[model samples]
Target: MYKNIKVIAFDADDTLWVNETYFREAEHQFAKLLAKYETENKIDQELFRKEIENLAYYGYGVKGFILSMIECALELSNYKINPKTIEAILNIGKKMLNEPIELLDGIEEVLSSLQDRFKLIVATKGDLLDQERKLEKSNLLNYFHHIEVMSDKKEKDYKKLIKHLDIHPSEFLMIGNSLKSDVLPLIEIGASAIHIPFHTTWAHEEISEEASNNFKYHTVANIKDVLRLF
Candidate 1:
């Protein structure tokens, strides 16, 4: 249904490569460490629910994410923290920091197919170092003609990205996982968006309605399925 599209902006984390799955695995390991102090009943759903709600306040990035984990560790430990346990938790974060990058299946083929038809840009928000490292390691960096890494994906960043690329809103499409960060803001700017939800923890941004005709929206189960749009 989409046509006349000149540029397509892709979210880097969950949209292009595997992100939340690694975080989920780390969370499970973190919980096992926390288990020594707090009961399963006390810290199960409540903690995760709070974290999801707090994402708006904290935002997403490794620094804030690691800080939240440290806070959780301190709270659960009742201040009686073990050095080794703290070390282990820090190690998990470190591992994530330097983790090997793996692109989601079919990402290369899809991008290659669309490269000649659309101007592909990597539009993501996070710590610059981490995001750059991930892109470099993933080897998918060269596919995107441009990269826009912002502190946040609000109107300001979207406007700047489009302006910098010299592309009009009608000619740009955003593909991402976070509705709040990627889809909604771009839609507000009169751009098209596609939502590719990952099977992992709750993202603060969730879509509540179907997309309107002026703005196209497509929701897919995974990254590989996103290729159908092009």
Candidate 2:
């Protein structure tokens, strides 16, 4: 199916390494720190709402998440959240920032095998500095022809990326875990996509499976399975 594909783009976070897992852990820690003010469920819901609301203002990544956590803490505490709790929240973000980049199984092997056959690039959305740091730590940076840290992942964004890379939509293939951010948009833009499901996904990135039925894309059980496609 990808015989014509000349450029293979990958989603860095969950696809290449563990990301949402860290966010989930941080959320748990945040909820525990605020347990004095609200139930964990309510805290989780409010934090998610705040994150979505703040997406445009802070964009995506750990810094934005830290800001949202702090805002949620203040609101849930009725503006009397303890300064120490705020410090704890900031510490959670710092811990995540320092966590090692644990690459998904077979990522290196797949990249090594395909590096000679296709132009590999990382097309992901997140805070630029943090993403660059993780990529540098992963030591997978040498495999990609380009690194695109997108502000958003919509059809228009993919269109712009294709134009920037000087490739026809038909010549591009994107592989990622989110159907909303990764698969559907690429399909809409006339590019091929492969969905690799991660164990956990943020609520905002989840979409009904029915929404994906309209498009033609591939789903794989493991990252290594993608090697079979090319």
Candidate 3:
């Protein structure tokens, strides 16, 4: 099925290494810090809304998330949020930023096997500086031919990337965890996509069952399974 595929683009966050997990932990801490003001469920919902609202202004990444968190805290607290809590929130973001980049199991093995046979690229959305830091620390940078830190993962974005890579849609394949950012967009652009779900997913990345079945793409249990496809 992949005989025509020459370029394989990977999503760098939860797909290649630990990312969403840290965000989840941060969210938990954020919720706890605001527990006195609102219920955990309400705090979670509001934070999500704030994050989406801030997407245009901040784009995607931990930095944006941290800012949204602060906004949510202020709104939930009716602008009377304590300064110490704000400091704690900032510390949470700091700890997340400094977290080690632990590569997913079998990621290195699969990359090692495929790098010689195909053009590998990292196609992900995040703060450019943070993404670069993680990639450098990951020790997997040498395997990719190119790296793309996208501001948004949409059909237009993938189309531009495909053009820049000089590959046709049919010649490119994307593998990632998010159906929203990674799989659906590539499929919409006439490219092949493989969905390898991470154990944790951001709420925005979740898709309806009907939508998942509507797309014609491959699904794998893990990154290692990608080896069988190629």
Candidate 4:
């Protein structure tokens, strides 16, 4: 199915490294910080809603996420939250920023194997500087020919990327953990995609089974398994 593929774009978060797990952890940490204001469940729900609601203003990544947490805290606390707690929330984000890069198992193997056969690139959505910093720390930077820190991963975004790469949609393949952002959009644009399920997924990135039931794509158990397609 991937024989026509000339370029392979891999999503950064969760696909190449452990990302969603950190976000989940951050959410839990956030919940604890706001525990007096609301239950953890309510906090999670409200924070997710806030994140989606603020997407237009903040976009995606740690910076936006931190802002969402602050806003959620303010609302949940009815604006009664202490300034010290606000400082603590900011600290949560700082700690996440400084966390060490934990590369997924076999990620290097997959990239090393496929680098020579295809124009490998990182097509991910996040703060550009944060993504670049992670890439540099990953030491896997040299494997990719290009790195696109996209604002959003929609069909049009992929089309623009394909156009920039001077390749047809059919010749492009996206391998990532999020079906909503990485897989479905590519399939919609007539490109191929391989879904590598991550252990954790952000709520906004989840799609219903009904939404993906009609799509034709490949799902591998792991990143290393993607190599078997060739």
lDDT of 4 by residue, 1-230 (tens): 88899999999989888877778889999999998878999999999999999999988999999999999999999999999999999999998898899999999998989999999999999898999999999999999999999999998999999999999999999999999999999999899999999987888889999999999999999899988889
Cα miss at 34, model 1 (Å)?
1.6
Candidate that beats the other on TM-score, 1 or 2, i.e. the better one: 2
The CA-based lDDT of model 2 is what?
0.96
lDDT of 1 by residue, 97-179 (tens): 87778787778988988888888999998778889989998888778898888878998889988898887888988888887
Candidate 4 wrong stretches, greater than 4 Å: none
lDDT by residue for model 3 over 91-125, one digit each (tens)?
99999999999999999999999999999999999
Query: Each candidate's TM vs. the true structure?
Result: 0.85, 0.99, 0.98, 0.98
Which has the higher TM-score value, candidate number 2 or candidate number 4?
2
Judged by lDDT, which candidate is best? 2
Q: Which ranges in model 2 have alpha carbons more than 4 Å from their true place?
A: none
Q: Which residue pairs show collisions in model 3?
A: none
Please give the range of 10 consecutive residues that has the lowest summed lDDT in model 4: 15-24
Alpha-carbon RMSD, each predicted model: 3.0, 0.6, 0.8, 0.8
Give the Å error, residue 196, model 3: 0.3
Please rank every candidate by lDDT, starting with the best.
2, 3, 4, 1
Query: Which structure is stronger by lDDT: 1 or 3?
Result: 3
